[model samples]
Target chain A: MSIQIEELCKRYGDKVLFEHLNLRVEKPAVLWAPSGWGKTTLLRILMGLEQPDGGRVTGVGRVGAVFQENRLCRALNAVQNVALVTPDGKGDPEAIRRDFGLLGMQGAALALPTARLSGGQKRRTALLRALWAEADTLLLDEPFTGLDPAAMQQAAALLRQRCAGRSALLATHDRAAIQALGWPVLVLAGQNGPESGGK
Target chain B: MKPVWVQRAAAVLFWLAVWQCAAMAVGQEVFLVSPVAALRALVQLLPTADFWGRVWFSSGRILLGFGLGAGCSVLLAAASAKIRWVDILLSPLMQLVKATPVASFIILALVWVRGRSLSILISFLMVLPVLYGAVRTGIQSTDPQLLEMARVFRLPRMRRLRAIWLPAVLPAFHQGCSVALGICWKSGVAAEVIGLPDGSIGDALYRAKITLSTGDLFAWTFVIICVSALFEKLFLWILDRAVKRVTGEEAAR
Candidate 1:
C-alpha cells in the first residue's frame, strides 16, 4: 500500500505553494524543509484539510496526526487527551499513564489538565495521542518544537518505538530531531511565486 | 472588627430602618407596609399547608418550562449549527418570541390552553432564544484548529462532542443559562399574574391587591425573590460540575 500524489497543484491568491508536484510514499519518510516551504500545506493536503488545485491523491486512509500546534484539549488531563483518540474510544488508563511516564509525565503532571501543562509536556501528549489512535498513516508536523534536548531525545526514541515499520511522515526544521529519527528525507516544493519567504 | 456576616446584618438592618421610616411617613398601609408587618404576615402564613402548596405549584411548573426550554434550545441549536435550512426556518420564530411581550404571550396562550399552564409556556418562550443564541455562538466560535485535529484523528462524533465541542460550548452556555434563569422566573411570574391561575402565587397577589393587604403582597414578593435566587444557584452549580466531568477537567481538590 502507498500514498501517491500525482501532478498536484495548489495556490493561495497567486502564491503557488505547489505545482506539478508528483510524489509516492511507499515507506516512512521525513518531509524535510524550512518553514513556509509548503511543508504544512502539503501535510494539510494529505490530510484532506485542503484541496489541491489540480491532481489527486490515493491510498491515504485513516490519518493520525500531531498538528503543528500541540492542539491538546485544554480542559482534559493527559490521560483523557490520549483516550480521546484511542481505538476503542477509551484508553486503558494504566497503559496510557505508563506510556506518558516513559515520555516523562509523572503523577501530578498526568493528573493536571493539559491547559496547565508546560509546552514540552503538552507536545508529548499530542504525540502520544496520535501514536495511540487507530491509523494506517501517521503524520507529524514540527512535533518537537517546544522540547528541551533531553525531552526531544525521549520523544524521538518513543516515536521510533511506536512508528518503526509503519507508514509515517515527520515534517520538521529541527536538525537534531531529523538526526535522531534518521529517516530518508523528502524536501517540500519551494513556493512558485513572488519571493521565497520562510514561514 | 465585625465578622462579614455581622456587617451584612447591620447593612440589612439599616435598610429595614429606612423602609420603616418611609412607611411611617407615607402613613397608609395601601402605599407601603413596614418590614415588621411583612415579616409578621410571612410568619402567620408559614404554618399553613396552603402556603407550601402554592409555593410548590408555581415552582414546579416554572421549572418544568425552564427544563423543556433549555433542553429543546440546546438540541435545536445543535441541529441549526449543522443544517443551514433549519437555522433559516427557525430564525423568524425565535425573533418573534424575543419581540413579543410576555403579557401578549400569556393572554394569547390563555385562549389556546388552560390558565394553569400559562406560566410554563411563557417561561419556555422567554428562555429559548437566549439559550439557542448562546449555543450557536459557542459552536461557531469553536477553534478551527482543534476541529481539524479531531478530523485528522478520526475522533468519533460522541468523543468530539465531549472533548472538543463541549468544552468550547460550555462557557457561552453558562452565560446563557445565567441570564435565562433570571428571565424565566420573571416571565413565568409575570404570566401567572396575568393569567391568574387558580391557587397560584399570581392569584394570591391579585387578591391581595384587590383587598389592599399590603403586608401579604410584600411577603409573597420576598418569597418569590428567595425561591428564584435559590434555584439559580442550584442550577448553575449542577451545570458547572457536569461541564467539568464531561470534558475531563479535574475539579479542584
Candidate 2:
C-alpha cells in the first residue's frame, strides 16, 4: 500500500509550512528537499512523532529510519545498536558484528562507545540499525551525511540491497545520493511557497 | 606527586589540630575530649569483643535497610514513570517522606518495630526519597528521540531497558546511592541512639553520654564516621564495577 497525504497543512503559529498539499508515495521513493524545507517535520508527522495541523496520512507500517540525528545509543556498540531493532528471535549479535566488518568498521572500532567513534562510524551504526529493523517501511533523513565518497557508495549499496521490494522514503540534499539510489524523486520545492526555503 | 595516603594523613592531622585547639579552649574533659584522649579511648575499646559485636550489629541492620530501600525505590520509580496513576499516587507519599523529620520517623518506628530493628526502618525511610527522586528524574530525562527509535524498532522490554534506560539512569542512580548511603548511616545511628538498641554502637555512645565519658563519645563518633565512609566506598566501588561491566558488554557486543 502507498502512503497517501491529502490536503495536508502544517503551521507553527502564524507561519505556515504546508497548506492543502497532497502527495502519494508508492514503492521505494525519495523526497528530495534542501535544508529547512520541513522534510524532517513531514517525516516526524508520518512517524507519528508530530501531529499535522490539518491533514491525513495513511498507510504507514512499522517504520524504521536513520533520523536527522544519528540517534545511536552512545554507550552501546554497533552490533548492540543493530540488534536492538532486529526482530526479537531473529537477532544475531555475531552476524551484526560481521556486517559491521563488511561495512569496513574494525572489530575494535565497533567495540567502543559511539561517543568515541568518528561521525562516519556513528552514521554507519545508525544506518545498520535501521536496515536491520523488521519494518515494512524505511525512512532515511540525510542518512549519508557523514560518509566520505567511498563510504557513501558502500552505504548506498547496503541501503539498496535492504530496501529492495520494500517501501522507502529518503530525504536528502545530495543529488549524488538521489542519482545513486535511482529511486523516483518527489521534489518538495515550491510546495511551501517562495519565501519558504525548501533548499 | 603526593601519595593518596599522605594526603589523607595530612587531612586527618589538620582536623585533629583544630579539634585539639577546640578541646584546649573548652578546658574541661567533661565538655570536650582532645583527639589524643579520643584515640586512647578508641584503642581501649577496639580490643573488646563487645565493640566488634556492636559494630557488626549496627552495620548489618543499616546496610540491610539501605539495600531494601534502593531496590524498592528503583521498582517504584519504574512503575510510576510508566503509569500516570502510579505517579499521582506516589507523589504525596514521596512528599510526606521528604518532609518528615528523621527523629519523628525513628520515634514512630519504635512503636511499631522492636528497638533493635528501629535503625533499619529509619534508614530505609531516609534512603527511599533520595533514590526515588533520582531514579525518576533519570527516567524522565532519557532522550525521547532514542526512545522513539526503540519504539520504531519494537525493541523488547528487557533489551530496551539494557540498551537505553539502564545506561541513561545508572549514573543518576549511582549518585543517589552515594548520597543515600551516607544519609542512611547517619539517620540509622541516630535512631539506634534514641532507641538504645542492645549490642549496637549507638547504645554504647548513649551510655558514654550518660556517664560523661566525652572521650568515649568522641571515639564512638569517629568509628561511626569511619564505618560510614568505608561502606560508601565499598558500595560505590561495587556499583561502579557493575555499571562498567554492563555497559562494557553492551559496547563490546
lDDT of 1 at A35: 67
Candidate 1 on A1-199: residue-level lDDT in tens?
5778888888899787778777777767788766677888888998989988998888789888988899888888889898889877787999999988888877999988888999899999999998998888888998998999988888889888888766888888888888888777776645432122222
User: What would the per-residue lDDT of candidate 1 be over residues B1-253, giving only the tens digit for each residue?
Assistant: 9999999999999999999999999989889999989999999888999888888999998999999999999999999999999999999999999999888888899898788999899889999999999989999989889999998888889988888898888888888988998999888888888899987888888888889999999999998988899999898888889887787654311
DockQ, structure candidate 2: 0.51
TM-score of each: 0.93, 0.87
DockQ for all models, in order?
Answer: 0.77, 0.51
Q: What's the lDDT for all of these models? A: 0.86, 0.86
| Ten residues in sequence with the least summed lDDT for candidate 1 chain A | A190-199
TM-score of chain A of 2: 0.91
Evaluate model 1 with DockQ and give the value. Answer: 0.77
Calculate model 1's interface RMSD in Å: 1.1
- Each candidate's B-chain TM-score, in sequence, is 0.93, 0.94
